[model samples]
Target: MKAILAAVLGLALALPAAAGVTIDAFKTDSGLTVWHVEETSIPFVALELRFKGGASLDAEGKRGAVNLMTALIEEGAGSLDARAFAKARDGLAASFSYSVSDDTLSVSARFLSENRAEALALLRESLTAPRFDQDAVDRVRAQVVSGIRSDEKDPNAMARQAFDLRVYGAHPYGSDKSGTLDSVTALTREDILAAFRSTVARDRLYISVVGDISRQELGPVLDTLLADLPETGAPLPPVAAPAFDGQTVVIPFETPQSVAMFGQPGIPFDHPDYFAAYLLNVVLGGGGFESRLMQEVREKRGLTYGVYSYLVGKDGADVWLGSVQSANNRIHEAMEVIKAEWARMQTEGVTEKELKDAKLYLTGAYPLRFDGNGPIADILVGMQIEDMGTDYIATRNDRVNAVTLEQINRVARDYLKPEQLSFTVVGQPKGL
Candidate 1:
């Protein structure tokens, strides 16, 4: 059945994309809002569920409780033990993945229309009746601990942690979501349960379903699948303040190359000039080899192999950030080049050609995101999370194209701060 589903998705991808996408939005009897795209061509359904409060909902000292609970969700449920749960899920050839980041917990599911009931029943059990048996908790906790230990020695991880620590201070975003070794070791089963209950309630849930489901079928489906969840989860954390000081901080690590994470403040998604900022980022550092940072730092000076930047507008905060790794000896030069480029953009902004190319690439690439049901479902959920309307799909390209060069340049001058760009370098290098 999985193979058949895969083949069906492949065929769907091969067909030409429709010019416009029609999304139907409705709420279930239980007041669960769901966005749906009914693609009848395939006998498969791709469903995505997003809960707003993610690892950030960890209770006091139980830092990684939410992450650990998410990992244990699929380990067992109701009457099914870990191995039994796997066997049953495989029997139906359904797929389910549960993941949590700092601000969101996501469940992605794929199943044939015929197996919908079984898949959703199994899914419900996982959500509302997770066993969190001692052995499964211990096993998954060990895996998470192992990963935490591994990250402690990783240079890139060092840079990220260092950067987060400086920017977020006491905010939950400052600490790693996976928790410290001691915190994970001390987490009790009750802690995991608390995390689960606090994170999985209905008020925080956003769902999107694509393929093989209709408005009528979806209402009962959502009610039956999700109505069991509590009415509300724990309150979300307070808004974070990202303090990006214009300073270069170094962590001494033994590595051939130094990894640098650099960033400053950024605009929110709903901000009116976000498209201009988005286009500006594409020209400045985000557009692969064509980006100004990549061209200057890699192609021109051969200072690094690759460099890129992006906007991260997390629910609590927003920032413009980028990374690059270079040999310890060349890292200083790379840092200087990146800073110069940052300042250059602020002073001169992007050329008309650069802005045009960014608009063209972004607009042209937007439609390709709908190639498969799963991707489309994921996109739909993300759009909803960003509070975008259903017409966003149809109007997105036009918005991208409408970003004038003057607007991007103005955003560049207003938002980019060379002096405020913080660089956290992780490696032992000769120079500053």
Candidate 2:
């Protein structure tokens, strides 16, 4: 056991030094793009399938259909029932996870090299031939409804829902990924089937594989896994026009502490100044204790225990959002401090010292993310989805390092809007 532990630690230490890891990328005859990183240290593989137009493809009045369909894909498929499918996966010692966010429905699996063929076959069934059985659909729908009912009383959930509704208005992004109780309860087995057929297709698929797999071997596997999916998915809705009027909307939840979620339109990931704005955001709120918001709101004034902000560049819209929680009486004070800091950042930008520290932390911490095969596969697929080039892994740190104080200040002024920032406070707070 000691020897095995030492070998694992040794491998972990050695992995960070392998900076020359190259991704082998190719397009299949069916037009699916697959990225591979051959890590031969373990006899295993981590695979991901990202289908675009996730929840955004839901038809009107059937808001949660796509989400429900995604959750049910692995419930059963073809000849296998839910119990049988679970048993088969356990027998092979493989894992499969199915989920959907606003923009993508992702299926991920990991398996030993010896069972690669079996694992891949199981995954193909889940994606291509999901049963969406009536019993299973009812069961999962009940689960979803339960979750929605719980979220109704959750202050944090209430704040997020209120914030998105205000910011995105009638757009699909305004709604929670899990549909409302009424919408979800209305979903039927046929709705799930239509959603599955419309969502899983080749035109918008993204693939990434890591571990003991060779390019020559992965080609046929890719073809087989995706062979049954349609050529194109239902077209996604147009890009959402996120409407933020900068009003401070308050939801009256009975809690001693109030939670505030705030943000406005943010720069897209593809924007030229994205990295600069990203670094600026780190100084503003993305960085934890070292960030300006943490310093002003918690460290100096003692208003709250934590506060943070981050960039949200979804496929349909981009945003900069943050959250904080404080006593109902002091929540308004917290908002004041946040607004002051927001304005101060646009005016003064980050100091040279702040910029240096942010760059050092950002650049140094990046390589740690590539330590394992599964994480590496995720990052590779994410880079491609964001349209970051194949060579991004090698050049990412360089880009972070290249952001000058001038660039950051320019982006700060352009992106930060104190007056246009909207706040959604959940809880009955005095002095709002």
Provide the RMSD of all predictions against the true structure, rounded to 1 decimal: 1.1, 2.7
* Number of clashes found in candidate 2: 0
lDDT, candidate 2, equals 0.87
Candidate 2 TM-score to native? 0.96
Q: What is the lDDT of residue 121 in candidate 2?
A: 94
Measured with C-alpha atoms, the lDDT of residue 282 in candidate 1 is 93
- CA lDDT, every prediction? 0.91, 0.87
**Model 2 vs truth, CA RMSD:** 2.7
By TM-score, the best candidate is 1
Task: Give lDDT tens digits, candidate 2, residues 275-361.
Answer: 999999999998889999999999999999999999998999999999999999999999999999999999989999999999998
Q: Name the runs in model 1 displaced over 4 angstroms.
A: 15-20
